[model samples]
Target chain A: MGGSLLEQLPLFLSYSNVSFLAQAFGVTVALSIVGCVVGYTVGALLAFIRNRHVVDVLPARFLSVGFSETFRRVPFLVKLMVVFFAFEVVGMRVSMFTVTATTVALAAAAFSAEIMRAGLEALPESQWDAAESMNMGGVMSLRLWALPQSWKVILSPALSFTVGLIKSTSIASQISVFELTYAAKVLNERGFSPVLSFGSLLVLYFLICYPLNLYARRLERQLERPRGWKSGAPLLAESEAA
Target chain B: MHYLEIDRFTASYDGKEQVLVDVSIQIAKGEIISLIGPSGSGKSSLLRGLMGLLVPQSGEVMLDGEKVDYTNRKSVKALRERLAIVFQQYNLFQNMDALRNVTVAPVKIRKRNAREVEEEATALLRKVGLGDKLHAYPDELSGGQQQRVAIARALALKPDILLLDEVTSALDPELVSEVLDAIRILAAEGMTMLMVSHEMALVREISTRVVMMDRGRVIEEGSADRIFDNPRTRRCQAFVGKILSH
Candidate 1:
């Protein structure tokens, strides 16, 4: 009744076609990169739109709040299925890759817009006052002072969200997009070995996401300062001063 | 003519409460006008009104006989370039080092020569006695140092009038004097300033004219010597007595 390493080795080796797995892995990565970059840009723009109290008329405010909320409430799987299938109803035929990437990007933008809004709001009013007094009010003030301070608040969460998006790419396999998970499913179907094929797939995902998690944690550590003092000696001190 | 005139300015935060009511003030060239009042007395509202950070329900700020149209963005921006403010909290830009914090607005917004602005910023930092801490971020500096950097940044704009809103109020007791000392230096050099301060001693020493405010109105206006020594109103006398005793 004991499981032997020798028996498992052949099962794993039998499905290891270098070219096929490599192609699937490449597609999965490309999808995630495209999703995150486009997602963050759109999300940042949405954050700005939602924050526009200066010119905030009723219609613009409602539209921004409504769109972000709707996207945030919808589940990613449902969103993906809707995009993949619904377009055909309107006489539009989009690629499986395009559909998957678009769905992930939309989901990511909703989440990130909220994160960026929170980050921007956390800044003190004095930051704006100081900029305005120096004749640097409006968009110039937001760009130079407010936005830069918000990056530390935005970066770690954004990166963690990106990792989640990468994992969620496996869902795209349901559309038969032939990313990593779909590749594993194909191998398992052919070889009649569920445990070996799926376990290796798990290992491959861990390999992709672990370093990202590490980097995010490192960034978080850099953000913490004790008694308003950052780690390490003061960067540039006059020789005579304390 | 008054160099800067604030005529019948009124300000409120929420509709329910009036923070400042029909406040008028005038300053000649090179006058250090200090606004002294108890908390919630609208000393800051007056300064905010002057900076165009707060819109007045009914009032006007005139600079050198020209009416400033606060509603117009171009007018306000042009007005603000001639006026700079340093807050009680310092509000230094944490993203950049000390030198860059002072240099950013001049180079970016004013479209000034970067090299010229950098050199002037360096000189300004040295004037504030931060000659050695040019590259230090706000987190790395003490409250006094950060406040000093803020002062230098304000000076870099070359404003015709400087507004300081309780600049030293946020500092630790020991740190307050260093910031006050920097202000003292500016006063000696004849910088025109309008300040809201609770530091009576510094205010008395630095102000050419001092105004006492209460309940959104100017209660008393006189020379600093008279206000501190012989206050006319019961409120001014009581306020001065209470602060001096402390």
Candidate 2:
């Protein structure tokens, strides 16, 4: 049997172990945040394609609906394998990290598209009518009037979804990506007790995610303030110069 | 060419259900033409169709001798730039204050100087009696005040023609006259206007011409005296009798 946790703690906290875990921790953070940014951009574009007032092309609408509907229904792990083998079958060698990150982005894009669609729908139909009648383009209406009004409806859910994606990045371990969960498993297999190995992971993940949870809650509170509490129509000025 | 012309126009919300069936009317510049009829008579649909809000299935809407092709973006944009409509719901941008709602299109879409637009918007708001409520959000204002903001917003565009789709219909009875007073100011100034209104008194007092519609077609139209006192069609007379009796 291994020595008591107190005695084993020093070896576990060695410089090499610490560095390896640090690298793994960095990977987890990068995967989630980068995935979210890429996911959101593509997702918003997908939403625009799906919007009748914006795209108005049936074929483009079909493609957008198909992408969101298909990706949203697939299990994340299955998506990871599909992506992994997709690269392999294409004869393109890619890193396991690339494979995992791509899967997270795929899942995030689908969910983010749906979330954004809901946000856009939250406004009254007349909002679009007013903008369209004013000769404001569909994209312009979204940026100036529609998106700003929908931020409160979108923010809480979007942040929460990002947090869920962060936790879900644990599944990246299945592909042998060097993220937190994989690091814990390696440490445990190397004779550290499961409690010490997994427990430390528990703390580290909490360290990374709790502040974000707090931040999401804070943002939700800020946005939950009554409508018209905003002092200005700032969105009107944002992209007009472009 | 007439300042605005809708000739044998047929339109639908969905392709199958014709809401504006063979609807045709014309407005000369500076004329206050009121559309009056029972609910679902498609009076409002004519204005919406002319804006390209409805699918124009047949006929034509010509402005200043240019035919409006609703399927063409530039044509629709040009049509909208020349004509602006205020809804009965007062579809002011809920995210904006009265002043911003009034100024957004002129400054952003029209690309006018922001300062000049604001100055004009402020004056327009004052004209509609919304000067005191310029900073107020739509949710913060009463129905009459909000509709006034919508009117000011529409006027800020400096359209060749202003369309009011039942502006007073959504108001509380006490709130109705404030909106009417604002429209009366426009009437006095000889602004080109097309309005769908149930306030027969306002329509009678301000409209040079009145068009009565029923089941997606214009049943009769003439000077207010002709339409109100002596409607030529049974549909028009029945509609006027039912509306006025209330």
Candidate 3:
């Protein structure tokens, strides 16, 4: 049996153990970022494909809708297991990290697609009508008006979702991917105190997520205030605020 | 050929309920024709359908000898290039200021020189009496001012015919005159316009012709005086009598 927690402190802080934990930390970060980046790109595509204003193909719309609805309803661990077993059934040999990362991206795509669709749909019909009357194509309409107007709606929630996604990456450890939670478990089994190992995860996760959440807030504030608008000024009527 | 010709045009908001049914009209160059009808009488739907916003299920529109096939990309493109519309709600891009709202379509869609478009847009805003409010956003302006900016935006496109859909109806009672004054400025220049208006006095003053609609059909049409003072159809007479008494 390992001695009291204080006695294990030296061993836990040993250079080799620190390096092992460092590698686990790196895996967690890489998994979250790569998965989320892929998720956002594909999710935005899914949202547009399903959008009636942009696409008219019935099958394409149905497929995206089905994918989003199916994946969003599934539990995260269940999704990881499904991906893992599906790869096994296909006779593909892949790393546990790859399996979990793919699950993160798939989950992200489904969730973010709904976020994007909500933002795009919230725009008034008049905005689209005005664009259509001018004969602006879908791309041109999005570029000129819809995107500029909807970015605040799309981006704030998306970035906040990213922070939540980073937390969800801890679940990857269950697949033996050596992410934060797995790193903590391995350390605890190797005679480090549970407090020392698990406590480190709480700190590291906070470190990874706090700045991202702050950045999201800052970006939201920037988008909310259009150029030439004075902060805290009352809306004027036919009078020069200048 | 007439400057604009719409024949037997029929359309529905949904595929089921026809908003405009067998509507027909003709306009020569430099004529201002007003569509005056009861609410939900398809005045706005006619303008929207003509622009291919509502998708005409069955109709033929010929503009300057080129038939607009709304299903065909090139035909719709050619149609839009020659026509512009000002919505009743003054649907300015909320992200843009008044000047940018006026200049965006010409510079972006038409690929006009930006500098030239800016100058023309400035002049157009000035023509509509919003010279001082060029930098203001839509929300920053009064309802009357926003409508004028919308007018400037449509004018900057230099459409062969402008369709104004109740341009001043959304304004407050006091604000209505300012927007109407701007329309009078356009009328004085002899701009070809198809307008839907609740302002009977202005319609009578500027319309070369007036068409009355009820239940999605053009029931009566003639000079503003003939339609307003001496309508032929009993329904039109009752409608005009109700409007005139107000």
TM-score per model over all chains: 0.90, 0.95, 0.93
Interface RMSD, per-candidate values to 1 decimal: 7.8, 3.7, 8.2
DockQ of each: 0.34, 0.45, 0.34
- Chain A fold similarity by TM-score, each prediction: 0.82, 0.91, 0.89
* Candidate order (TM-score): 2, 3, 1
- Model 1 residue runs over 4 Å out of place are A1-8, A11-16, A53-61, A222-242, B14-16
Q: For candidate 2, report its TM-score.
A: 0.95
**CA lDDT of each candidate?**
0.82, 0.87, 0.87
What are the per-residue Cα lDDT tens digits for candidate 3 across A1-242? 37887888888888998898889899999999888988888998999888887776889999999999999999889999999999999999999988988888998999999998898898888878887788777777777777777888888888888888888888877777889899999988886888999998889889998998898889899888344422111222212222
> What tens digits encode model 1's per-residue C-alpha lDDT throughout B14-72?
54467889898999889999999899899988888777777567877899899999778
Candidate 3 local lDDT, B169-235, one digit each (tens)? 8989999998899889889999999999999999999999999998889989899999988899998
Residue pairs with backbone atoms closer than 3 Å in model 3 (clashes): none
**Candidate 2 Cα deviation (angstroms), residue A235:** 9.8
Off by over 4 Å in 3: A89-91, A225-242
Comparison by DockQ, 1 against 2, better one = 2
Interface RMSD of 2: 3.7
How does model 2 score on DockQ? 0.45
Model 2 residue runs over 4 Å out of place are A225-242
Pitting candidate 1 against candidate 3, the one with the higher lDDT is: 3
Task: TM-score for candidate 3, please give it.
Answer: 0.93
